[model samples]
Target chain A: MRAPSKELTIDEVLGRIESGMTVGIGGWGSRRKPMALVRAILRSDLTDLHIVSYAGPDVGLLLAGGKASKVTYAFATLDSIPLEPLFSQARVERAAEFREWDEGMFQTGLRAAAQRVSFLPMRAGLGSAVLENDPDLHTVRSPYDDQEELVAVPALNLDVALVHMNRADELGNGQYLGPDPYFDDLFCMAAREAYVSTEQIIDTAGLTVDASLQSLLLNRTMVTGVVETPNGAHFTDCTPTYGRDEKFQKAYATAAKTPEDWAAFHERFLSGDEAAYQAAVTAFREEAQA
Target chain B: MSDVTRSEYCAVAIADCFADDGEIMGSPMGLLPTLGARLAKNTTNPALMLTDGEARILRGTPPLGQSGDVTEGWMPFRLVLESVVPYGKRHVMMGATQIDRHGNQNISAIGPWEQPTRQLLGVRGAPGNTVNNRTSYWVPKHSARVVVEQVDIVSGIGRARAEAAGPAATKFHDVHRLVTNLGVFDFGGPGHTMRFVSVHPGVTVDEVREASGCEIHADGDVPETRTPTDGELVLIRELLDPTKLREREVPSS
Candidate 1:
């Protein structure tokens, strides 16, 4: 993996993503969501995309915009975060198809892909409304021949995984500051290409400081291309310099209660240049501080 | 015909679920999580929100708590699907060991429950998930410990500097409800502080007063929890069972 001769803006990297492409977004619930990339996508023309994520506002925006053609994930969620209107419309109208799996089973299915398996089996989908509605979810008989139960899920192998690491070395090796890997390793390994978005690209000398560091690396050989984007993760991302500001989130949750509201909120927050966003949010902070 | 196919069964079961009784804010606790899940949906992503001409209330199994029971250990069926896990669920009822007048929660550890100290489940998903997920809280015991000042460890997301230490920090997200042993509370006020919404039946105002740790917008005559609708009961029965143990089929006598 050679270093890029030139640096690029977050938007430059995102401009190349195509429609119908399977994308793996790095984040679990709300921690370390690739905010920069999500903002770029929100402002991009790639309206039809297939995404995979654990949960966050990034997925919420795409799903709301009708940009997401499909999504395969272990959870569709918001944590303490306000609701997303797009998901509501789909759920009620039955426009979006959901495949059911238990919490463990969802991880197992992704593991199957990371391990390059064709499918995974579990007793998660039983008695689920999703199981009743989704044709993609089917029952696989237990091989043990004891209690015949329904268990089956199609293996998810992604085209590319968009990951934002806390810090990454030039070689693409990275470290996360939060609890676990936040589903990035599995999502990346399961995909054909892994596109990393890092807060900062530092030297690799500090790699062995933590034991888990060695365990998380998926050799450069497996990674297709590395794109260095700073502040690439937003809202959901955890960058060391700036912590999650409650004032901002409360405001965002308040302002963006619906798609129309989100569009307006985005215009107020996401649509502007970084300077404007910084100024607006900083002004908001100042007001709260005062 | 399947039990759910019968509308009568569904309605009766839902009604029983929302009946307010002795088990903590038992009744409204039954109703609100489902309501939160549905209402929170319209609030989160407005673009896809549906205000269908008809006002319909979708009674979903709110993650934990079985159809006719109250407890943890079960997640709602809506969260099972991979796609649903990522984009479907926006809010959830969190269990708290401690809370504040503002809707903050703490589930880190316990003290003198039996021994002098109880090492509770260390904020398993509370740190990142609480803020990242739309979180409300239900504290079974209404006491000083359950309602406290600043918490020991802010595991869930918060507004001031939560998850701000950088990518590693995910302590602050949303803190919505604080349903105590006596009543229901909401935290959408200034600084997102918790406020009393309603109290359960059989709970006197003094009982609620004695139980709450912080200031509450107490209601003199709180109403009883509505009966759980049949649709909600069906959703709960077929989807999430709080104990995690699957329901057993009837045996022929």
Candidate 2:
């Protein structure tokens, strides 16, 4: 009755995307990114995208592939590995437009969209170069207190938001089994449509275990499509369940340093289907164990 | 038996960044900051709210990257952001790609806005953190490129500039200290300008000037940064950072 099971294939989820649309990729730094969905996006011919993310590999891969025309993010890092080298190189070459904001300001913009507001006023950007760099941003003095000048961060409404969570029900109730949920729900809420990929799809009864997942759950109504992709957020961490594949991440970081290396790395890891990628991972793990 | 490395001295200087604070949440970004916060928590400021790199507000200073089966209680990211941060009771020591005389940090970019020549991380909570809590900086490699005349982009608001913004910005605007590989600095100088507090064991006043791109106000004899005590050395080596990752940051001969 309630649009019964919004489940779709990763391809179908990616098909919902079009070129020249603002897409928000969910996750924090290098953790819990919707990497499988990102892989599908990468495999497609969708080019000149405007991506908004708390960037990890999704931004780096997109930028590296030259699919993204612009990127709006607070920070772009691979966490332990630090700077996404490809993104750095791309920026140095003037490859893409960067609309950088303070993390709180960026999150506040998402919050503004989620609240269906045009803009939200905050003091985060006043003393910083955020307002100076962006000519479009305007400040409004508080009515009650004339001296308080707050920078108005415009709402960031995305065409689509892609997020990877620990688990979700068939009904699209997403849950994160990590310490930091990291504004995944806000990404869903700020987007016109949202697709979530999860490690597993449990029953509705399993959604709540002693109310542990209550705060961690993304409302099913906001989620348009759900795909069950186990070990979905690999390379980037899923946490508690599994830490980042540091070896693989190191390989990617190293390979991404040069164009020739990135191409080989992409062909070996990203060019293939998710199954092939998983197999390669298995092979790598076996070799490492050996 | 042997002398402590420059990296060890740098860690002690970083720890001194939090030595004065009574009881507050310390979120030290990067490896050096992490070591500094841990060292401070274990030694001087036991009241520091230390997280076990997971959920719990750790009572004991556990090893870095240790997770689960050890935490005292749940202190989710939500609680930290919403409650801890807003309370103005947090001290964050983060990296600065470029920092000016006024302590204005640039972790954002190097060139123009539309197309920066070299883009680093975005502002990334720097504005809010600097505005909301006591913020310090840790620069791994201090040179002219790092301590510049003017930062290309200001991610974190410095002392004088934050004051100029107004009382609203000035209330929580406290840029306490900046610990570098070469020396320690603070904004307590004239007009809240960054002043050279001390140099490391082997570093000299001339070395600090040679490294600084901007004019660093140093009136009196700049003392050598305090070396880590024997106990601190043991604690840092054994419980805090067993892997000796700090050595890799600013390696000692």
Candidate 3:
């Protein structure tokens, strides 16, 4: 007997998420992200989201749209643009709660959650301000003779995990063609459910034909649903499929200077469906060339 | 030999950081440090491993902004965080938004951590990099605002903080040299405070003191920063950075 297909629409994926649920977004700072699903969440009435990510524009967008109430992240940057303007603005204004951890500690938290462990010990945040800033974190001493102490990074379990990939099948086996798979697999494993948005949905056999076998980052068992959304990681780089839209990203960064500018940008690019947003981006590119 | 620019001097000083770092990974963040790492790999430290800033380990040091011939190994982000970082087999030179006398660095926010006046990159990898591996800093422009008495946030663990963390944290926690445009500094002074090693050719000790917010020890006679050799100058100009991007970073006075 064969397994059942788990294909889903953008709306159906968003339907699974509720208010104040912890959501883990995969990708490292302005790389492949599930922007289409994020866009749908923006258009919907979901509020008070507890967003977790090795953040980029997704955190900025959620903060800008008032969708997230708190954010747990290692850093929030747009790569080219050093600081994400909206997220920066939110921090300056103290608009939302933030639980900032060290990069390795953040990864350990996810690993702990994936492994079904309460916490993991590491040396990343031992005497740094991360422990001082967040009072919740504690240190643990080893039971051995050496009795070394380390930071007890708690598990960052998630209600849902959203990720974007190069290719996936109807049965939700995700594959990445980029140079780095990042921590996308860890995010999926750490969550109660995982939905992957991919550039193309091909036959299961076709995934291994051209790509190396190691590129298959996510197995079908780990994934709950797969949505085929072409160019789903716009503004962020999707690697061999396409590079980041630098012009659009610059425009996005510039528009965050003021509320009036953001409002105008919202009217032009956002405040519409995925098709409308894509169409506006096309128009934006044509206008720039002209 | 042609006149060596301040940026070139800074690059050579950065290269000297890895002169004896045999087979460990060298991760340099910005343009100047990238050039320095490549220069070190090409000339002095051939065994120093470098990555393509994404995944693959370059077979040999390539020129700036171009992928080299091939990769010797694959070091993706997952492997980097899981295997490479924890193993303490890497030396990283990262940028600092602000640094203090004790070498506590900050690339997080300005003002209070609760509500920052200006938010920078939020403590990205500094904590892990400092605690888990050999770390250094590259400050392109040194000023009172950057070289502070105390950092707003301790993104990277400094000498004092490492001492507080006890023996286990101090084992791999080596906050080495800090290379700036004006001079090179290290935490070797009394009480492990920042100490001035040398000044750039045109720069003076008074100028460095005036620019710094913290007390930089210059007890003995200070020396001028070493200029690159004719061969090194050729490698820097014709091979490594043909585009002259280093000029944009540290412009000639």
All models, RMSD in angstroms: 20.2, 2.6, 1.0
| Per-residue lDDT over B125-161 for candidate 3, one digit per residue giving the tens place of the 0 to 100 score | 8888888888889999999999999999999989888
Tell me how much of the true interface, by contacts, candidate 2 captures.
0.68
Q: Write the per-residue lDDT of candidate 2 for residues B76-137, one digit (tens) a residue.
A: 65465556665789998889999989989998888876678887887888888888889999
Q: Rank the candidate models, highest lDDT first.
A: 3, 2, 1
Candidates 1 and 3, the one with greater lDDT: 3
What is the per-residue lDDT of model 1 for residues A161-244, given as tens digits with 9 covering 90 to 100? 877777766666667664335567777788887767777766666655654553344455455545565545645537353455
Error in Å for residue A202 of model 3: 1.2
Query: Model 2: per-residue lDDT, tens digit, A6-107?
Result: 889988898899999999998888999998988888889999899999888889889988899998888889988778887788888878887778777787
Candidate 3's DockQ is: 0.85
Cα TM-score of candidate 3: 0.99
Candidate with maximal TM-score: 3
Candidate lDDT (C-alpha), each: 0.52, 0.84, 0.92
TM-score of each: 0.52, 0.92, 0.99
lDDT of 1 at A130: 30
In candidate 1, stretches whose alpha carbon ends up further than 4 angstroms from where it belongs are A1-9, A89-101, A145-150, A209-219, A237-242, A258-261, A273-280, B1-253
Q: For residues A164-251, what per-residue lDDT tens digits would candidate 3 score against the true structure?
A: 9999999999999999898999999999999999999999989999989989999998899999889899989999999999999999
Provide backbone clash counts, one per model: 61, 1, 0
Docking class of 3: high
